[model samples]
Target: MSSGQQEHEDYPVRDEQNEAELQESEAGDEMKPVKIPPRPKRRPRKRKFVAGLLAAVLPGAGHLYLGLLRKGITFIFLLLLDIMALLYFSSIGMQINVPLLILLALLIPVMYFYNVFDALQAADRILRFPEEHDPEDGEDIKSAASARRRVRITEPGISFGVMLLAGGVLLFLFRQKPPWLQAFIENSAGAAAAVLLIGLGVLMGIREVAKNMMARAGKERRSRRIGRYTASATLAAVGTLLFLDWSYGTDDMMLLLKWWPVIPVLWGIEYLLIYLFSRRSKPGGTVRRARMDLRGLISAIVLAACVFIVTEQEHYLHLWNRVSLNLTAAAVDYGEAEGHQFEKPPLVVPVELNTSKVSIDAINGDILIHRAAVEDIEIKATVWVDQLDGVLAEAIADQSFVEVSEGTTIKITPQSKAYGESGKRQPRINLDISLPEDRRFDLNVRTMNGGITLQNVEAIADISLETGNGELILHRIFGNVKGKTLNGAVRARNVLGDVELGTSGGDMSAWEVSGAMKLSTAVGNIKAYDSGDAVDVSTKNGNVEVAGARAKLHAESLNGRIHVRSADFGGDWEVYSAVGDIELFLPLTGNYTVEGSSGYGDITTDLPGLVIDKKLISGQIGTGEFKLRVDGNSNLNVSKY
Candidate 1:
């Protein structure tokens, strides 16, 4: 091409190249990533009060807020079952285990309140913590140093309260003047040790609970609390050993020693739940993986060792082979009772009177006294003229349980002698008194080695009978019947009377009575069948089953279940249990308000309008008044009816 033509072409080519370069630069600018705006954190709804209120009314309702279908349904099902079971078992004549029933009852309030608090807390988190709601900022903020430092600790007042409680218990012992107290006082060391151990246990338990509430979720706090519990338990075991060896009889000592193994098992179970269930709730909670508390483990091992040592006592081994699978009755003594019974003349001694009181004293024989239409005093005895034998009997009777006074007071007493009246074989003289049934009279009889049978008797005054090792049978007796036995059953039937009977180691049953009844037993079942009037019954180591009882009811048991059925309910009823379930089988239409509590278990009921608050289960049925307490362990399946 010519020079001018070449210059033009070059200009056009250069211009085109410059345009392409500029266009490429512009495209590059368009392709560069844009600076995007960040998404805003979700603003949680403030519905804590509503959520908690719903949960309180019905367990698992709060979980529904989180759209947790399975959890919510499970909570409702379990809670409803707990309460329904209470009503069902009670109606079925207690065809179920008492402890299990009580445990189910206890779950009502526990789960109910737990869900309430849980819902409230969860609502607060969802509403107040927007940062935590964001996926990018999911990491939890570290807790404040001050928050960790603030801890709840047992104060000086708690220690003082512990001392006061100890003192109060001791005072009660003295005031009650129980038969066992005399023996306990004679052995001061054992009594002191028992009291000390009880105090220690109570104080430590209080301290531990407080520490748990105050302690932050950390290994150090857990270890410290474990050490405290272990130390307290060790002290209790040591004290128990000393007390058992010095004071408690061989049987009681052996039983206590064998039960020591339960301590470690319980401890292990509790710790297992704590560790296995512990989870990180907040983001900062996972800053470091939670470690097993070595100190706590060490203390727990020490506690186990102490329990083992207590259980493996040398003295208990000899009795271990004879370990009774069935618990012995508290009042009934096994193995033949070795004692001398003087056979008095088998005679009917009836003392007719200007005074409506009849008194008779005996050394050792059954006292059979019944009325036979006689108006005056009749001494129908084998005339083995008895004297208190003030000098000889007192000196000879190694064990005499007798007390009688002169005058219009009817008295019967036991005369015990290590050596009987020499060769007399004391004629077996039983009293069969004849009295006019038209007039009522005050009657009192007592015996040591034989039973007391009072039949076809009518008394204007309170009739009292006592025995040391024999049964008491009363038939068609009028007036209040007060009977006590140390080693026998107390039974009364077809009597228009107010019954007050107590036994240490035998069953007690009262049927069809007119007035209120009070029955107590230490180691036997108390059964009241088809009886009227208010009933006050208690047992220390046995079940209390009331098939048909009415009116004001007060029943208690320390180590057994309390089963009650009443059609007539119109009084203040108080029911208590230390380690057993309480089942009430009564019509729902009855007018009675129920107030109940469970310490370590659950309180549940199926009846509508029942309210469960934490450890409390309360509601009004008709409109009477009553109170019940179940001091079962945590998750204790017990509720007093």
Candidate 2:
């Protein structure tokens, strides 16, 4: 059987066993896990202290530290751009100053993003390769050492302190002036100094406090806190300025210095105190969380204050002045001194009527007629000397007048002048009359520049009073009243008759009126309160406010708002405005034919009896019962509760 044959068979078996061993080795290699080295833990790098100091001085220096050359240059360019924009706006007569300010406002976000990104990248770079610390001095080492030793005394606190000192010095200098000068200084400089000191203190306080708080907070919360604080401080400053300006009539600069500087200084002090506390506390016991909740609360309070101020301003501007009755009339003639013989010297004819009716028409002075029970007419006539060279009062006292009529027709003329020992001209003669109370006759009175007031008068027919620049006041009157004024306000209170009041450019207010009230104004608002029966008010350019109106109300405005509240209407209610919104409030059971429409707005109605016309959605409201029309392109909704 041969040794060669056995060896060959053993060799094949040996090869087969070798192949199995190779496959087993390959399977074990697939199942085994490979050893991998752990990635080095990333540590944020500490930026060079010099870089931070430089950034504090000039906004983008930190980017330069991270070798972001283009960004650093861009920062400088933006700063220059802002300066140039400010100068350009100043040169443009300040009309475009708002646009420049808005541009600056937009730039703030850009600068913030740039600062954050640069700081993050700089930190990353520092962590990646920590600058080698050398015990032996080198150029970089010396530079870093010098930067660390550099003291920063130009911070906001230091600047504000310097300003405060300067202001105090100026105030002291101004206070050393003479009495008149001292008064002027007190009015201007002393007030200004006080405001400046307070403002500086507040600003420094807030800035220091925020800075300290941000340092204690982590990166994620620091920026948010700073932003919230800045916004809150700014709003507070603006509000304080406005309030001071309105109440005291101070200039904007004085107001700002009075209030704004105090916030920063106070905040800064608070921050310093907090930092001191943190430094004194045990290392692990110091709280590390950011004060985000506190900041949010402050922001909310600021917003609420702003809302309150806005609402208060709205109400104050809407309130109209109340009307009162104090009547005075005077008429003087200069024609007598010119030797012009007068057909009728300014006469005071007191006539009494018995029918609750009185009327007057004077060309230059006021004519006042109060209702009383008079049986006949009374006249008081006084004539003045027609003197050319004497004083007006002397001529009037030197002259006397003879009564022309006894019953109603009273006509008197001015007499010649009397010469004095000093050769001075004097007046001739005039008459004076006192009438009975129970007069109902038609009395005529006229005036040009004096106001007329009718109080507690009962007239069956009518009373007319017209003035050029004086106010007309009617109180507790019973009868139809007609009043006209050129440049003064007309006020009617507790009038139990039909009222027709007209003003050319002043405000008109009617309160506690009984009969139909018609008020018209050219430039001021018309307000009617507690009006009885139907009331009709119209204005050309001012707002109309009506409250507690019982009867139907018809109000029209050309350029302002119409606000009606708690009004009940028996007949139709109509309101029209050309350029403002109309707000109407009624009771749940208030019923009438309601019609409302707007030209370019929606009609909102809470009235149940409203019949809305779809096609004229911009023109009218309600159906056949009541109609209200408004013209604008705003929102109008009618809701029923």
Candidate 3:
């Protein structure tokens, strides 16, 4: 004990010099200043109105000015393509379509406004915000808490299921072109939705593994949050992919459906994995029950309802074939051709030098035409007789059945002779004619109950072929070709000039035509491929499919489907249907504005400013250089090639 300690009695035993030294050290620590860190630097805000004005000069210049590289590049590429298409089509002798011009005019100004709006949004984004801190966590106080309120979705798996369910309903109500699209969605949409649900459940297994590893580092809560987000993202992506596949037509529905059972098996395996991981966690770590994702179950129910409406109900086709099945009226024969047919050596008649036009009128046989090697036009036909009347037999016996009559006109078909029986029955006759290839003359051939084939024929004047109950085939016709059939298909290939073909009860397909063309069918599908210029194709009760048609297109269908692929819209396009889905497959860089509506369905498309109102779907894709007006009662899907 020191003398200073004895004097105070209550203080610790210490020397006087030591106590004074400790007091001086305490005063020095109190005089030190507290240090405060500097706040982070923030980005400068740009004026939205000024940025928008710059965009008016070029489509994406405004966005580029605001440091958005991706959005600016996208806008530039789209606008450039629009200008290119317009100039290219103009050089091909095609007239500038009015609707297309108007669309381009409006799109330029609207884009300017949108660029300004986008820049305004970017300027208002917050760079840094308030954070959180726990008083008990002294070590964590040195770092920013980075606390933020996020939307904690309840059952993210279930939410994804609802998205898929809504998609199914939309697909069923809106019929889109490309029959493959509907069939794939109907067969595979369910499987895809189910797989996604199971995929989310599998994330729970991953979480368990991560939780065990994190528990060793005392970060179990972090692992839990990560797992929750991963699971939600998995489910969300699955639902988004379904819609993306429909928009791009890239789903492997057939391949995926091959092993649908694996979807459930994968979930079972995940459950086992989760169980093992949970056991490996820290002693005091919590383990919650893994709930079964209900998303798949919801998708299943919705898909079932949609399938019933699409297949068993036949909703789209019933618009055309839903007549009462009652057979109250007596059946009436459609009148079959009944007559004894007579045959003779094929007649070969040389046309007079002055002949310039040829006409053939046959009652019930096919008409075929080829270029004859001879110097003059020749005719070959089979003579038939049901009753063998005197006038008919006399006309056939003599080669005068076909002779040059009026100036330059050759009449091969004999005048119609009523065979005294019911006017319904006519003698079956087949006519095969050949003409010089170098000579171009007017030609007309008509048949009541047979097909017509014109091969490699060049006509200076109008060439017409008509059939009542058989197909009409035209190959390499150089002039204006008009072909029609009442109960058979119509096909034209390598037609050089304008062509028009129509069929009442069969399909109509045409290809390689160098001029404007029109083909329609009443009870069957219509397909036209590799043809340019203006085209008009329609079908009343069957699908209408067209590919590689690069011009103005007018396609129509009632109670059927309409699909257009790889069509270059150099002019206006009008596509309409009653119950069938309408699909227009254009290149990803296609520039057009589609303005139309659907009565009972919605129009689905992916574009910058797409607006879907009640029965109305309108949007500007790319630069909107062209106009595509599609109207349908069921569904309309626009896809990128």
Candidate 4:
């Protein structure tokens, strides 16, 4: 009975199940025949050209226009940082940091082009993968956007932090200048560069370490790049060596710069070590070595080229010295502080000889000759030695003396041959001499590294003065004066005879000369006032000014103006300039003939009777006796005094 009843019930259930299975199969077949439409294409962004133009004009403008707020702000911030750095370097007025300033200057164009290209690429990326469109691939687009956002935010923040750190370091250096830090700040570009590279390497190594830590924490499938670590370590090592040399005042860094071939050898060794250590066993039973990608190769090439250029340059190859520092108007504080100064007692010498001529020679000291009422010659010598003790200085000073020679010349020498034999520890000797003012004597003075001053002295003969690198001054000298210097100024006042002065790199001036004057300089101005005789002045690169000249006057300049004021038309006057103007002032009642011509310029006359015509000026105020000739490459102006 159960079999018969179950058969009927099972038959209906089996029929219903069969029908349900057939319906499901039919639904599956229908769905299989229908295919999903391809993801919709994102329309290209409008005004793409305008966005690029804006980016070209301003680094971050295009990114802002493309709705990338963070990226745009980052670009702008970097641009501003670059500008501020440039301004800071330029405004510092320190010529020593020129290389650093140039390096920062080059970042301007690099950042500009990168920002433009990045903006364009960002627009293209949006066109290819719109955030809101393509619902089927929404997850992929979101992940891609998230990755880009992370990179944009992380890199800029890291850059900003690095800049802040550098600024803080510089501020600290400027505020607290320690003894060792002075070497770094004393016009040594190499030290600063080393610090920069070391800081950058440290930052890079820290970034890589942080990335590895984060990857491990997130269980991300990422392999570390060995090239980055190698580069960072190399930079840090090189920078450390440079810093050591600079801080310790050693010549090791300079030697390294000269022997630049060692750099390539070291680089090869680094690569060999990297190859040996970077090998890793893979899952396929094979070993793999690290390989530099395109980015690394480019970076290495750029860095090598920069280093080679800097090291090979003649100017940057050597460290700055005291002479060079002084040339640039920088004080020789470091070098000067290395010496010990010592003063000795005065040495009195009686002039028992009937000689009226006195001569003094110094190796490295200033000489001052003063007029005194004493009958004997008084001498005071000051010495400076390289050693800390005063013994060397006193020894050097003891050997110096004054004596009456057999040739009737009173000889005063500050240092003897023993001082020269002292080698690098040789001392500097400065002398002060007092001579009798009632008697007229011939003065002869020469110095190597010191100034000469002779004031209120009655010289019976020509007063000769010469210096290798110091100034020469003559005041109230009643004789012919001759002065010459290699790198210092020449000034004379109240000279009673002919005056002759010449310098290679300093000004020459004479006031109230009672005789003819001749002044010349290669790189400084020439001025003569109240000359009683003919005044001749010439310069290669400076101005010439002559006032109250009653005799023949001649002034010439290679690249400066010539201005002459005549008290009377008593002699012929000639004024010329190679690349500047000529201005002549004459008395109104003089009988003079004026002849003036200017090349590529006009000649003007403010006198009542003189006129300028066709770049030439020629006229006469009365019966022509004296002659005035002015010629130059620039303008020429003649006027009445």
Candidate 5:
């Protein structure tokens, strides 16, 4: 330890002596002084007011000015696409205007903020990092001088070539004399050209992408090999599928293979074959590999064939046994005579309609008979059915007659031949009647599976229509109507009469109604718009929407919503819902009487005159001529401007 310490101490002393000697030598040598270079002056950056303005008008314009051309172009393209989509959707009446406006509103501010930020940053960078221009070499100077000359000469030649080629192609295809040959050659050439162009473009794009990926990967042989193999396999599979589909008409094969039962059977057979082949093969042998390859090829071929057969069969079947019918005239006859007392017999004793007078009923398969201008008639007819021929024969047969002593009485009896051996029957009759203008008729029509349409028909007294499973459409009717349907919609348009519609399971819609409207449905919505009188709509499980109504509304839904908008209530408005929202829009000036209650909901109102009594509101607005009441057991809200 002592010897090591002595050596360490002696090393410091030797270093001090060497330093002294070096300093003495330097002093003797007489060193020269160093000179410092001056710093370069920084230039002021130009203002980017134009760039910022452009960017404000179009997103990414400032970036384009800053030489971020790729990013700038991408942003501009996306912005343009978004704008076009917004405009297209708006023009198509998609009702996405509010959401689009909000998005655009937000985007504008964001774009402006980004543009200003980027412009300032770009200007700052330009000011901080100015580029130095270098002197041009002889070759560079020559190249620059020749570039413009070359472009000037090449531009005209390129333009002429493109125009000549395009014109020649168009003329060859369109100006050919022979029609069939021209069409064939033009279609073939066009298809070939399109395929070639698309193929070349795809090949070039894929090659460029592959080159970039390979360059980035450097010498990573494993990664490059895997990438190449994966791309090659995918391309091969796609090309194979396309070739088979085109050359062998494999579309039908694919369809057949897609059948529900066929797919499972094929899959099971394939797996079973694979299992058996694997069991028979030796481990790590070429035989197993060969078997696998053969199985895959066979499976693909079989599946393709199956699909083709199914597709072709389905296509053929779809083109069979389709019937089309156009109606020329349709009329309905109710047993009524012209100008006859309700209790008087008809003047014409034997009322008969010839076969030529009636048009054959082919559309809905319904027999129609119309009495032109007869009154006070009695029709007692025996309707017989030929069981052997399945034909209905209706005749008086000397036993049946209809005696109309009073108003027109029309009676419908089921023919005996219409029944099967088991006594089951089917009613296939559709009747549409056009009553005489300014005349009234009481129609009692019944059908099992047919519809009755009455348009421009008015009953001065009362109109009643009943259907088992068909729709009843009443349009422009001016009197009271009572329409009932078992399973079809009841649509009344421009009806001036008091309407009462009932449906077991169909929608009820009334538009432009002048009188009080009442509708009930078991499982469909009730929609009324532009109604002048009070409206009441009830449904077991359907929504109710009333718009532009100037009368009191009482709507109830057992399991749906009630929506009312722009309503002027004469008295009160009530809406009941079991599991849906009640959205009501009322005028700010009208007084409202609201009685709302919910078992598990809130009752809210924005009206100043609305007085809340627990879940009910009974109040007056302005002159307070009418009282309003709305009662329910759900969330209720009232709002006024």
Candidate 6:
């Protein structure tokens, strides 16, 4: 230590000797004074204003202009994603969670303003502290505290990205609408909300845990904050209530609305009592004020909004019904639910046709055509309505009448002004049209929210019938038939012409048809018996049974069984089912070849000489002239009867 001090003490003596030698040596040359450059000027305020202007024009452009590449790129991406999500939700016609949509929509403006403010703040920081705000020295600038704050600020973006991605996937699925997803959407609205809330809570809890771990790792003081779990707890409770409603069809939403004051009370208690207690009992024996959490307030508002919406959805529906006339009162079945009935006086309208065709277009009513003894077409109209007072019903019925235009063809239609006022609460006009037996008039009838019944009317021309939400009953019709309904059944018996019928959610049954029968339904059974020429039957979610069908047969069912028994195979037959069995019965003496295949199912045949494997069958019965193709996911049974 003494030697080191002596050396330190001798440093000044050596320096003085060097200085004296230099002064003697510098006598021959001149030494110039050193110069220092001035500091660079601060950036102009005009440039800062331009950056803010760019941010106002577009979210992240100002950040890019200010040379903050990472922030600029992130903000731009977030803006694009937000705009894309908004456009998707607005354009998509599918049923969405409206509350969630509104919340996301609210975030767009919040994020936009945040971007502008952040850009301006960054520019100001750069102007004030140029050395500290070096964009190129991002790694050096990102202290642990700043990095943590950045993570906290961007956490909402991560959550939003997850939500947007999920919503996009759901929207895609809704568009495609596979059976399972459709069912889930139809029955689990509350459950879906619950799942969303649970996911958000889990993300928040995980974030908090990660932040605590990070702080601990950095040896920072850990302070337990009140309302840290309050938001999560509140969301969980509300989500559980909604899920219970969906699971058990309960009125918990209304119950929650009734006792909603409890939530705020408990939230206040946690924020006040717990925070004060935790502040006093510190781990290091030092008191620190815990920062207030506004998340609980936000969560409470969202929960209250959701609760009110669910509880009073019926009133909103009624208001919507009033605003949107396209929404029919038949949607609510006001006729049965309102418990008031009114019937108008019957009106008989005699129609005379110059041509052979008679067309009837009616709305919110049924059209019944019957054989009459009179020579001309006699129409008896009766109007029945509910949910209207006597005065309104009388006025509606007085304006309702059948207009018969006897031009080249006879057109009979029921018109009512009530359709404009009360929407589908307009009078239900039931027309009993009695057609003459001698005059063979072609019948064309179409109606909405009502049925079409043609009973024992043999038309000379083609019989065309359509209804929007009612059945098409064709009994003993002796003409070519074409019938369609969106939400009702199609039943045709003893039809002596080509039959083509389709329905959306009702069964199709054609018995003893003398001509070709083509029938289809989206979610109902199809049964065709004794058809001719050709027979095509298809259904998405129901069974298809054809017996004594002597025609070209094509039958398919997506999730149900298909059974075909042919009196005689007139043409090639093809039958298929995606997830059900297919049973084909042929005549005992037929010259036909059969080929069948199955997936994970047995392929069996009782015919004489047919080779059959577990999943395939290919053989000829007699002459091998005709072809029969059968495919299914389950069993494929073929037998000769």
Error of 3 at 73 (Å): 84
Note the Cα lDDT for every prediction shown. Answer: 0.59, 0.53, 0.61, 0.70, 0.51, 0.72
Best by TM-score: 6
**TM-scores of the models, in the given order?**
0.40, 0.37, 0.44, 0.46, 0.37, 0.48
Report the lDDT of model 2 for residue 96.
22
Q: Candidate 4 or 6, higher TM-score? A: 6
**Local error of candidate 2 at 393, Å?**
3.6
TM-score (C-alpha, index-matched) for candidate 5: 0.37
**For model 5, what is the C-alpha lDDT against the true structure?**
0.51
| Winner by TM-score between candidate 4 and candidate 1 | 4
lDDT of 1 by residue, 1-641 (tens): 89999998777655788889999999999999989899965555647787777788778887676443444655776565556555644443111223334455666887888778766766665565434332222244345432232111101124445544654565465445564655444447355755676576567667776765554444334422223454466556655665676664433444544675665665565566555544434334542223444455455444434443333433222122112111122322221223322323322334435457665545455677677666543334321223334554333333433333344544444443333434333323345556665656777675544678888888876787766667888888888887777778888887787888877778888888888888888789888877778888888898888866666777888888877766656666777778777776555666667667777776666667668898887677765554433344323232233
Better of 2 and 4 by TM-score: 4
Residue 197 alpha-carbon offset, candidate 4, angstroms: 72
Candidate 4 global lDDT: 0.70
Candidate 5 C-alpha lDDT tens digits along 1-641: 69989998877655788989999999877775666888865544445776677677777786666554544554565455445444543433111223334354455565557666776565555444333211121123235435444332222235445544654554453333345543443235323433443453356347635753564444211111112222223233333443455456454234333443543454456556545653453333323221233333343444334333322332322111010000111222112112111121222333233201111111121222233344422222222223323122232112222222221333333222223354343223223223333345544444444455666655545565555456878777766777666678889888777887887788999998888888888889999888888888889889999887677777889998888887476755667788887777677786554445656667777777766666455566677655555545567666762
Residue-by-residue lDDT tens digits, candidate 6, 446-561: 77668899988887858877666789998888899877777888899998898988877898998999888889888899998888668989888999999987767889999999
- Point out where model 3 deviates above 4 Å: 1-354, 385-406, 415-425, 606-615
Off by over 4 Å in 5: 1-416, 604-620
User: Which model scores highest in lDDT?
Assistant: 6
lDDT of 2 by residue, 175-287 (tens): 44335543453245334534543464366447656765666553222322323444445554555554465458555534433454565565565455545554453345645
